[model samples]
Target: MSVTYLEAIREAQAYLLEHDSRVYIYGQDVGAFGGAFKATKHLANRFPGRVIDAPISEDAMIGSAVGAAIEGMRPIIEIQFADFSTVGLNQVVNQAATLFWRTETPCPITLRLPSGGTSGGGPFHSQCLESIYAHFPGLVVCTPATVEDAYSMLIESVTLDDPVIFCEHKYLYYHLKAESLPKDALPLGKARIARAGRDCTVVTYSAMLHECLEAAEEMSAEGIELEVVDLRTVKPLDTDTIIASVARTGRLLCAAEGWPWGGVNAEVISRVVAEGFNLLDAPPQRINAKDTPIPYHPKLWSVHRPAAASIMAAVRNVLRS
Candidate 1:
């Protein structure tokens, strides 16, 4: 009786709709078509008028949701892909982000991004925009890896005052599962230590967390312990936990599915060197997707993003240094 990451998300939305009348679902084909990924399957029928579909315009979808949120409604806008969310950048960054500060009215909007690269998705459909949205002032960026967090975090997101970027990895929708939905979860902005070790630290989130865990387990066979930390939410990153983990491990390796430049990996490495430089025995390293657009070919896509083999190689490098 395992619940998948996709199912967990559907359940979470169902819970929100049942519990909170203020909550509603809005996005392309979400009402009758059940969304492109079927994340909203049967939701339109169950919730009738509440689950409404919007025009094809991403900017308009977000703009209306932002306005609805400001008027005391909590709207969840589902972007078909994380890459497509860029179309609504102005509404997200300019309107939803600063509404609370500029007008004193909380804009509680949750933007669900079907994020991360999958085989055949290519560059247009595959992208990790968590780091980009996290850069904004009034946005809370969440990268949920586990089914538990997927269910719990989304429910929490719509309730918050600030706009939330929900980065749900497309790769994990069916691949990751749990025995039961979580009743309660680690609060947003808290990092979870997935595995404990003293040799080195691998800080990661979302789908990359699973890959890092696999690498850590493989390295254990060689007596090279790798501590794995899962940063549940990227914005308001839990630096205290990350710094403390590096202090114990004496080495750091930041990993993410996004590109290396100005991404979560860069931020983690920068923080460690800036705040916990004395604790490290070697220079902090980071593993990221190659600096190129995601390719359509399976072979090319396989190597484009960080994988277990790549992460293992990275840990071995940290150990050597």
Candidate 2:
């Protein structure tokens, strides 16, 4: 039987709860309601008291989870949406992100953000906040593109003794599927070469990886090879793998679902220029969501975020440059 990306996430939580007594779940409507996307469906019943329902306040949720982590408990906190996480920005950045640095206490807390845009989700419910979280110190921001990574990385996040931002795209919850969960995966902080090519590289993460892969398949008939790299974790970025991909392809195109300015795209390009300037045959290019609020209309939302055709155009532009 095939497992979808959403199911894989649920399995990961199940794994954590069954294996680790210290690991508990805290979120809004998670106990009986099973979460906004039902990612935590039935976990409350299966794990009994381990799965809890938090107050509607995002700040309180993170704050309480932080305290739990301090007392040697690993807490998996789920925000209803990526945009709502902003409400707990202070706790994440100042408290959880700084716990280790300030007093050497391990804040083993996992914040699962159902990120990225879905049709009609609008600005409030849909957003990609990976770049914002990745900017801070002592936080590991993971963007799992595949079903396997979604399961494995989340499990890994709970195991680590630091704050982890789990950016699981909402679009892939039902759109993507896998035959089975991976027994072994590339270690966290490493990238995967989703598709290899010699002409140019497309560096992306999360749901954007699907669009880049689609672009790669479509452009193959035109004799334009496109290499695609899935940066599994945005914060602890794998610069070595990314630079090597650029060295082989001689060009880079960074595509992301977030806005273009100062995002993962910009971070990748800056690193390549600083550390692998000699490897590029041409300047790197990027394509991202337009600089505006996420539109509610499906038609406008489709064009707002980077898609296969837009990724194709960016890749072609980089190759031509």
Tens-digit per-residue lDDT, 203-270, candidate 2 = 99999999999999999999988999999999899999999999999899999999878979999999
Where is model 1 more than 4 Å wrong at Cα?
A: none
Task: List the candidates' TM-scores in order.
Answer: 0.99, 0.99
Evaluated at residue 297, the lDDT of candidate 1 is 100
Which residue pairs in candidate 2 have backbone atoms (N, alpha carbon, C) closer than 3 angstroms, thus clashing? Answer: none
| lDDT of prediction 2 | 0.94
Instruction: Give the Å error, residue 252, model 1.
Output: 0.2
